[model samples]
Target: MSLRDTFRRDQVFAPLRPGTRPVRPGQLDTGGKHILYMEDITVSFDGFKALNDLTLYIKPGELRCIIGPNGAGKSTLMDVITGKTRPDTGSCFFGQTMDLTRMTETEIATAGIGRKFQKPTVFPEHTALENLELAMAGPKGTWQALLQPVTGQQYDWMAQTLETVGLLAQKDQLAGALSHGQKQWLEIAMVLMQKPRLLLVDEPIAGMTRQEVERTAELLQSLAGEHSVMVVEHDMEFIRSIANTVTVLHQGSVLAEGKMQDVQNDPKVIEVYLGETG
Candidate 1:
């Protein structure tokens, strides 16, 4: 069957996993409104400032797109939010209660922050279903996962997640057998398996075909109402499709923030992000 046919047929009956629970649609900002906040976040690498007093705030269930030129500290911002890199001085909050700055990466993830890296990281040897199973959230004790198989609710969650990411039919296929775009979606599905409150996605359409990119845009858009997504991406077209609010960065600070059209029309934003010629 053609890829299109496969997608249509496979999309149906995508929720057949046994012993899995159906993840309830919950508020992305479970901690009472404020999902993420960064104030005066600054980070430097040997005197070269990567993030200079950067501040960002994301509202609950908002799909925010961040665009910037090279060396604008986009990646560093994500790192700070995820607790992978602590800033020299700043405050990061996961909600009204949890202070992200004091937490470790693992702690932050457990606190409802899920990050999808630029590269897909699914285990090549594992089937897509197994890869997602390994990512199920909760106690990491081997006994909890192995001796006690995932409950039906968990399986339902996984199945729904697979369908959401457009990979339900490929669940039995080896991760190694998927195409580049499919692998990217698989990686995203793995993250969804944990049912995070906030999701941070990076360059989701980096190397996808035109059709794949469009479909991916639709998927992300569908997820916005249920998850607060902070996407750092370079593809302006893809950003336009998914962004409800656009932020432009230059020299580690916000240069422009508004609708895509407004930001694009800003002369300074044009000079920094879009060339004057374009």
Candidate 2:
């Protein structure tokens, strides 16, 4: 059966696993609104401003698409969210009380924020199942985690995750032998293993075949209702296929945002980005 067929038959998308560690007072409190809040964010390099007073908000379980031309601060915006680049000014919060600017990258990830870069990164020497095993979030170090045997429950969860990503059939295959698209799916599966509340995916379909791109769109769409997903992509067609709300970035700030059609029709968006790419 096809991936879409399987998804329809099983409805097998797993619920996001909650953080295993103890929660601090107000750690994830969002006042029942947005899961992410970035207000007046600014970042600069040398003399050039990579991000300037950019404000964005992501509600719980939202799938938001970000599109822009080169040097529009798409990458820098992601860097700020993942704690890779500290902004010169702004208040970034995960939920309501978790101050992202005050946290480390590791801390941010552990707090249920996961990022998947453009390139697929997987353990080539290991089987698909083994890669997920290594990626399972826990207090154990890498070597220590590898040493411990997979429990029956853990194994079942891993199997389910593979199925969710349409990779159950390739579970025993070496990751290196998988196709490029499959490798991308494997990396996504690895991130899913961490059970993040918000997922950041950068250019997910960059080198994918048409068929692969379709599958990727379906995969990302299916993930939305349970985990907030932010996708930064250049392909207008792919974005149109998956986007409900699109945000266009220009010169380090949001130029336009709304339904895809509205954003497409925006005069500013056309002048800055769509005219060239659309």
Best by lDDT: 2
Evaluate residue 113 in candidate 2 and report its C-alpha lDDT on the 0 to 100 scale. 92
Residue-level lDDT for 224 in candidate 2: 98
Kindly give the stretch of ten consecutive residues in candidate 1 with the minimal lDDT sum: 16-25
TM-scores for the candidates: 0.85, 0.90
lDDT of 2 by residue, 1-278 (tens): 74323322123233311222245853676453578877789999997999988888788998999999999999999899999999999878787567789889989998889999999999999899999999999767767877899999999999999998999999999999999999999999999999999999999998899999999999999999899999999999999999999989999998988999999999999998999995
* Cα displacement (Å) at residue 40, model 1: 1.0
Model 2 misplaced stretches (Cα beyond 4 Å): 1-26
- Model 1 regions lying over 4 Å from their true place: 1-33, 141-148, 276-278
Number of clashes in every candidate structure?
13, 0
Deviation (Å) of 268 in candidate 2: 0.8
